[model samples]
Target: MSAGEPGTGVRARPRLTVVSGPSGVGKSTVVAELRRMDPTVFFSVSMTTRNQRPGEIDGAHYHFVDRARFDELAGRGEFLEWAEYAGNCYGTPRQPVLDALASGKPAILEIELQGARQVRVAMPEAQLVMLVPPSWETLVGRLTGRGTEDPEVVRHRLAVAEKELDAQGEFDALVVNTDVKQAAAELLTLMTGTAVRKPWSSS
Candidate 1:
């Protein structure tokens, strides 16, 4: 399909999908599965100062950069949205996402709640989606199950999750991440503005 031209079954304007949620709600899992199911969906790689975890590639997972470089980019107005979390700075570059959307490819941004809110203000047309767990207990289980954080860290994340959940109304839609397959499918549907089982009424 040509850029900005609707096809028989495809959307015209490229979709900008902002997926945000608490740290442990499986946002990454849903995004990974979406990319696997539809490779054409462009997933924007973020720039971060945090050290790479196991199995995370430099450019593929994130654009690993030093604090100085990150500051330089930020000064140049390179990031669409950025924030500091847990003593590390993370941000999304502006150019790549704009280019992808210009080329008629759906761009997916898996970011934090604050970043998502920033994008909503900057790009009103972008679709905002929040991934939620089935329940509080489930969310806590997923967070601790990762085995990547200590008790203090887990508690902090849960506290943050509670606040994030309270901001669900700010998003255009909310997809419960109880079932990975189902959530991914719903996300794809939201990105395309196509019909799937209605998760929540969009505001």
Candidate 2:
């Protein structure tokens, strides 16, 4: 939405919301559930310089690019927010999100904490939601059960997650993801200002 029209006093609706949490906290799963419940919501896809993993599609999961191209885009100020993670750079394209918002669709960004903070500064009206694990033990279990990384890597992730958990107070909404359905219901309530649906859609 554009700024208030000059001398018209017409206010614009805030349309962007950011969701962030520690790694392996099921941010992706929660967001996927939100999309399933509401097909109209526009989720922002991020760009990254990392190699694509199995079952990931470019432009859908992420806009995979080379480091040089990512740097070029960053230098051109085309990104709303950008950050380095695990030696790879990731960023959100500015225009697409604005376009989606301008069309009256709510734009949801699932990003890391650093990028979320950058979005907050750039768009103060954007809502920020923190998705947190139900407990430390649950978080550790989720991280370790992935079987994707070594023990050392899991330990490092847990350390980083501890810091992320402390930043929950900085968010506008805190959703505890003990149950995916319940957590998705809570998140949808925050996004749409509606009561959590009973018998939330499973199809």
The candidate that wins on TM-score is: 1
- Global Cα lDDT for candidate 1: 0.88
Candidate 2 — worst ten consecutive residues by lDDT sum?
Answer: 194-203
Segments of candidate 2 deviating more than 4 angstroms: 1-14, 194-203
TM-score of 1: 0.85
Q: Rate the local accuracy (lDDT) of all candidates.
A: 0.88, 0.86
Cα RMSD (Å) between model 1 and the true structure?
4.3
Q: Model 2, 81-165: lDDT tens per residue?
A: 9999779999999999999988878789999898999999988778899999889999999999989898999999999999999
C-alpha RMSD between model 2 and the true structure: 8.0
**What residue pairs clash in candidate 1, if any at all?**
none
The TM-scores of all predictions, comma-separated, are 0.85, 0.84
Q: Write the per-residue lDDT of candidate 1 for residues 1-203, one digit (tens) a residue.
A: 33433334545466689999998888999999999889999999999999999999999989999999999999998998999988999999999999998887999999999999989987887888999999999988888888977899899889999999999988888999989999999998778754233355372
Alpha-carbon shift of residue 23 in model 1 (angstroms) = 1.8
